[model samples]
Target: MSRRAAASILVLTVVVATAIGACSTAPLDVGSSDTSPTSVPLPDGPRTARLPSADPIPVSPTPTPQLPVTVTTADNRRVTITDVSRIVALDRYGTYGTAVFALGLGRNLVGRDIATKFPAAASIPVVTTGGTDANAEAIIALRPTVVLTDASLPSANVLTGQLTAAGIPVVTGSAGRTVAGTDAQLRAVATALGIPAAGDALVARTDSQIAAARAMVPRDADRPRIAFVYARGTGLLILGGPGSGADSLIDTVGGQDAGTAAGLTDAFTSLTSEGLIKSRPDVLLMMTDGLASVGGVDGLEKIPGVSETPAGRDRRIIDMDDGELLSFGARTGDVAVALARTLFGRP
Candidate 1:
């Protein structure tokens, strides 16, 4: 992930989550429409939710895009899409790409963003440059029939404006993303593409997977405090506080959000020695690439006051793929289960 992508993780989630209130107790309404996920197979006590490494997206309910549909962009522009045969979805976390694939339209995607790390999009042409920033020239060169993008990218508004002027229709989803809006994000893409039924099916499947994973947490076990640290080197290190997507992940895994508990109100804040000590986290969670940027676990300990905390003293740091950690789409359930299994441990 680029440094820009890492920073947007904070920007995206907080924008839409401000009115939703507390991050820890906020619940995603999966609705009361279906039975429990017994058919999905619960774990055998110690472990659950085993997933294959490649993370294949199940394109069930075979999507048949019914274009010529009129949709409203996040910017309030009314866009009518006539052709989805050549589609381009872009965002900071690859969530937009995941949404398209989730709707069974991956084969239609002609271009991808830099943040797409999932195995399925491995061969797609990358249009974004250095970070998740849109390369206007590259994207325009593709001549996509329609472009699906969000404002999370640093230059998305300008890029979209340029694309609009070029006579290419652009359908913008929400300006940012959040764990609670996962289904909404997916639905927005599907709606724009005129495939609400397929979107509903995918949402149900994703919701079930997440529900099953959350059920694995031991009700009686003491919840561990987890701190999400975003590092891009010595000069730029931030913490995921309240309203940050990390709080939702921490809540999902039955853990306390250490940054919020430490009284940090802003979504992302510069990491300070005093703040680290005050959080008193049992484990420090980080993006995999972010950790590497600071020179790995050994180098992470060298930070001003990291070694003094319970997490640092014991070297209890858990890192996940940068693209996957905060994307909060398609693979969110698997991401939650992965973290839960590690933190909760074996029976």
Candidate 2:
């Protein structure tokens, strides 16, 4: 397929179309694999492997397809989705917001986080700061038809109650939380919005990109040691442990997580500069703004013992967008590709 054709499909159906600047060429060579649902044969109790019949059995043509209907959420209230025209996605999780955009729902979004920077989401209004913490008043003021949020969203029940009282539907999921789970969440959300087919296609595209990147990294080599550093105020780094999004991303890209070395938990643990130096990670991954705010590479090297660490010696520190790198949602596939490239140097 040609790039023009692919772009048209994305624009018409993929929701958040990636801006590739319009130089006409072949469509993304992600290469299609068969995804058509296969027919399953019935049990051998019935006649099996019968020869093609000359006379076909008469059957009903079909039943009228059901139109989009209201799905009552877990809170026990009915909210209809006949047609999703206007959406106010107060998604604090970057990937959830990005997934909405990717599903071609960007035009429907009325609110977003300050950290959201997807070109498709640029015109959408910012309503809240990005993170697990959400602003209910700011979100409600937007008057959205539907709201998409993460599973770990702080005050999730409170926000859902508020939205329900206001008659707005809320959809929450763990999709932007891990690679596999995130994929499943996307499918569920799309299906709920009456677009299961579209959701499947979007996942196919992203999954292909991730698979391509993963294929480049050899499974046999020792995993590269990676550390995630989040600046928490002054002189504090919130390090991610097992079960956190950071750990999932590192493992996906065949990198060993620094937190795992210390047997950390899913919650962020404070790490001293001395501890980081002791970890001596091969790659130091951090959110871009946070890394720059504390004086960039030079400042990082100045930390006690950091100057002697392998990461500092080789200057392997990599800064990434906070939302995309950390949000574990639709953009995670893209994140995986970026990390893979950084680790493998573009084979």
Q: Write the per-residue lDDT of candidate 2 for residues 1-347, one digit (tens) a residue.
A: 23222211111111011211111122333776644433211111101111112111111122121337565443455556655565655444555566666666555567766445556567877665433346777777877767765444456688777777887777655433567776676676666566666677667866765675566565435566778767633475566566556787888776778877766644466667666766667777777666766687777767665567666677777766555566555566666766665565542
- Model 2 is weakest, by summed lDDT over 10 consecutive residues, at 42-51
Instruction: Tell me the lDDT of model 1 at 327.
Output: 69
C-alpha positional error of residue 261 in candidate 2 after TM-score superposition, expressed in Å: 2.1
Q: What is the lDDT of residue 228 in candidate 1?
A: 88
Task: Give model 2's clash tally.
Answer: 8
Off by over 4 Å in 1: 1-51
Return the lDDT, model 2, position 328: 55
- Cα lDDT, model 1, residue 304: 83
Residue pairs with backbone overlap in model 2: 3-27, 15-103, 15-104, 16-101, 16-102, 16-104, 175-182, 176-328
Q: Residue by residue across 1-347, what tens digits does model 1's lDDT show? A: 34344466432221110011111222335774543322111122111223345443754647777768998889999999888888898887777787777678888888988777677888988887765668877878898989988877787789999999998999988855566788888788888888888878777776766675576565434567789898877787888788777888888877889999999888778889999999998888887777888998889989988988888887778877766777677667667766766565522
Candidate 2 deviant stretches above 4 angstroms: 1-67, 70-79, 129-133, 232-234
The local distance difference test score of model 1 is 0.73
Clashes of each: 0, 8
Candidate 2 has an lDDT of 0.57
